[model samples]
Target: MGIEYKRRYALLLAARDSEYVKKVYGGYFNVFVAAYGDEEEEERWDMYRVVDGEFPDMDDLQSYDGFIVSGSPYDAYGDDNWILELCFLLQALDSMQKKVLGICFGHQVLCRALGGKVGKSDSGWDIGPRKVNIVNSCSLFETLFETLPALTIIECHQDEVLELPIGAEVIGFSDKTGVEMFRIGNHILGVQGHPEYSKDILNNLIDRLLSQDSIEIDQANEARSKLEIQEPNSKCWQEICKAFLKGLWNEYPSIEQ
Candidate 1:
């Protein structure tokens, strides 16, 4: 038998695992893997806690087939040493045409790194389940998903992308955020919501935000109420993300129909 090649992927975690997440799900790494990873034995996923100054060696970057940047509590526009280094690393990854999937703060930072604009949302925080309208003109979306006009996702962000990078296209948007999702060519995709988050995780985060006084009591209450009414299209979003990262859309029979 011919030697089989293993597919390797990396998760560039940009946030610390909250105590609730640690205790409940083991960690954010496990949460992400559960959402986006294939169960095949030949696939491997590695995590680098970029929030804590950990990163893959520059020379080893190409060994992985894809990279995922996780949501963070930090501002994507901040000039923290690690943030600057991460921007540089993203730039390098961009030049190499590597597949990169950015979530929430990851979405914003990827935009900033690629010469786009990002800043605090004038509309304030967007928390809970939101309906994001998919752009029908996006060939990528057409190739991957059925003719669904929109998808609901859980969002928790105070920052948003004001302008897109050069040559970038907005693939999804919502009533609250204009750039709910974007892409640069086929190699980079950025999503403003958390597809990997479960309702419990978001509930825990909402409680944490209330405890920290980061959000007003009324806002927290409203967010929690909304969560009870709507549900995120998590499975659909996960399928889209996995298809993008693993290059599985080409094999999708929908394209031939």
Candidate 2:
């Protein structure tokens, strides 16, 4: 079946990329990306500008078969109202039985909306790729998550979900954080790792960070060093992506052949 007739997915990208223009998943999936934040990229993420200081109900969102929440530099625990709204959006998607995947900050949003709490990490910043253990097994994780061993994931974050939302299940974790992955419902999945990000995307993020003076030179270098050591996508990325996409396919097979 053609992508036009296939499942429609929507990516809520919190971070914008400027240097990269016109990039997509490069697959059969039909999805639209919406970026948030004041940071601008040479290539806009198709972010919606709220003139009335309120976001409209995007029809694409309502029809989306799946949702992917991208990582962000903003903290979910902050006083920003947008972050709170995004959290509610995630919960709404979950309640509607839509497939949702949250990465990094997206992961924290999932936790917080589920009656969970988010807080600063006492273990310091987590930079680079690291091994994450699958906490339990389920169909949502059948091929992708269940029994996955020490999968290396790209990570760069200082805050974590200190508490789990009510009825939330922990899918994976590590020594640094108690919950590495979680799911609110059967079809919703939230991972603290960046499985969809290529090293190039990470680089764009770094460039934006540099321009914004978000991180000192030494800190950026340190994180870059750690990212290399983490060696994201060293087979782990491909496997995880394959598993994740496959899981989605299995969940809702295309209507056409």
Candidate 3:
């Protein structure tokens, strides 16, 4: 389905507009998916080989200008062999100062890889377009819409970042979930919300999760209700994308323009 590809491509296009860089997908997805999303090769990527649960080679990671760790359906604290391997890979990538961006489960992986703790949250599930309060200034928040009410983003996750990775800056947060977002370094960022999700994409995702039994039946419907599904806030996304892009390039200005 184009649902998954559309969300992924949103991030890809954002990176494309912000200067120029070659991208590589470092998650687990089939190669055929690359041709399914878009026609522009440079405007898209096929990044599934990074964690194929087989023999993941990091050689491709080195050639890319930056990397994105896409969201996954698995829980980070679960008893899975691939989770540990992915954590190790993230840690190694961090050492190289790779400009890494992790979404949802990927964010949890960054936390675990860098000595942060992640497990089942007492809050159960954080779903819908909840408010993520800003705590401190970071690259992800530059030129962001902080003045316009709360940043209600599409968030879906059971495991939250309970601990901050070594020297990680606490950025935006939500009252519902304390650690909604954070940053480990100048180049590494983790977002708990789905800024990449359009309203339709998010609604469809809820349906898929319910059908596949990945999430509880009751919770999926409730999550959909909270999505806010209103105006298309491409500006909010610009704040996030530009911040991440500048952070990746280490181009933090004295004042956010």
Candidate 4:
């Protein structure tokens, strides 16, 4: 038999591993792998910390089957050098029609790179579990979500996509944000919530933000309170993300082109 190549994926990490995450989970890479990777598969996953100026070699981009962009504390609209470089990389990936998944800041930056508009949310910060209503008209909705009407996910962001790129479809939304999830053809997906985040992670982040005076005591308390009452539909989200990234939906028709 001929040699078989292992499937590979790239994580374009846009944020550093926080002290808490480093101590608890080894790093954000481990956390992401836990959420999206299949322990059974013999796949290879590489991480590129774009925030720290590390990036994958352009020549090796084609070897990766899919790419994921992680959330970041930085504003996606800022003209920072790394942000600009990330935009260029994303554009190249788009041209290659590689599968790419963006989360929060990743979602916003993906929009910005693909000729869409992104900016601060007029609704202020959304730092708790929120319901994101599925758009029934999206072609993949029936196949992926079936009769599910909405998804509850943990969210932490102040920036949002103001306009979508041409050919992009809004697949999910919520009362607080207009574009909660979107897709471009079969290759690109963007989510504005933290489907990969756990309650403890959010709690720690809240504490850090409070210490930095980023959010008031009452706001943090309210976020914490909401967490106690309802939990995120993490299992459902994991399926959705894995399916999109791993081409599990190849049997279905393309949602957009």
Clashes of each: 0, 3, 2, 0
Q: Global CA lDDT of candidate 3, please?
A: 0.60
Q: Write the per-residue lDDT of candidate 2 for residues 206-243, one digit (tens) a residue.
A: 77667887766776787687777666543444344323
lDDT (Cα, tens digit) per residue for candidate 1, span 108-143: 999999999999999999999999988878765676
Q: Model 3: runs farther than 4 Å from truth?
A: 1-46, 49-51, 54-56, 137-149, 212-218, 228-235, 246-257
Q: Residue 141 of candidate 1: its Cα lDDT?
A: 60
> After superposition on all CA atoms, what RMSD does each candidate show versus the true structure?
2.6, 7.4, 8.7, 3.4
Per-residue alpha-carbon lDDT of candidate 4 for residues 1-257, written as tens digits (9 for 90 to 100): 95454689989999999999999999999999999888878788899999998999999999999999999999999999999999999999999999999999999999999999999889789999999998878765567655565789999998999999999999899999999999998899999998899999999999999999999999899999999998788877877888898887544332220
Model 3: per-residue Cα lDDT over 1-257, one tens digit each: 44332223212111111111122232123211231233442334434433346423677556444456666667766557767777777787788886667777777778888989888889787766776676645544453433434566777777888888788987778887777778876677787876665565566667766777778978876776565554434346435544464342244333232
Could you tell me how far off, in angstroms, the CA of residue 40 lies in candidate 2 after the best superposition?
A: 31
Clash pairs, model 2 backbone: 18-41, 18-42, 135-171
Q: So what's the TM-score on candidate 2? A: 0.72
What are the lDDT figures for the candidates, one per model? 0.91, 0.62, 0.60, 0.90
Specify the poorest-scoring 10-residue window by lDDT in model 3: 12-21
How do all models score by TM-score? 0.95, 0.72, 0.70, 0.95
Q: How many backbone clashes does candidate 1 have?
A: 0
Using lDDT as the measure, name the better of candidate 1 and candidate 3.
Answer: 1
Candidate 4 local Cα displacement, residue 227, angstroms: 0.2
lDDT of 2: 0.62
TM-score between candidate 1 and the true structure: 0.95
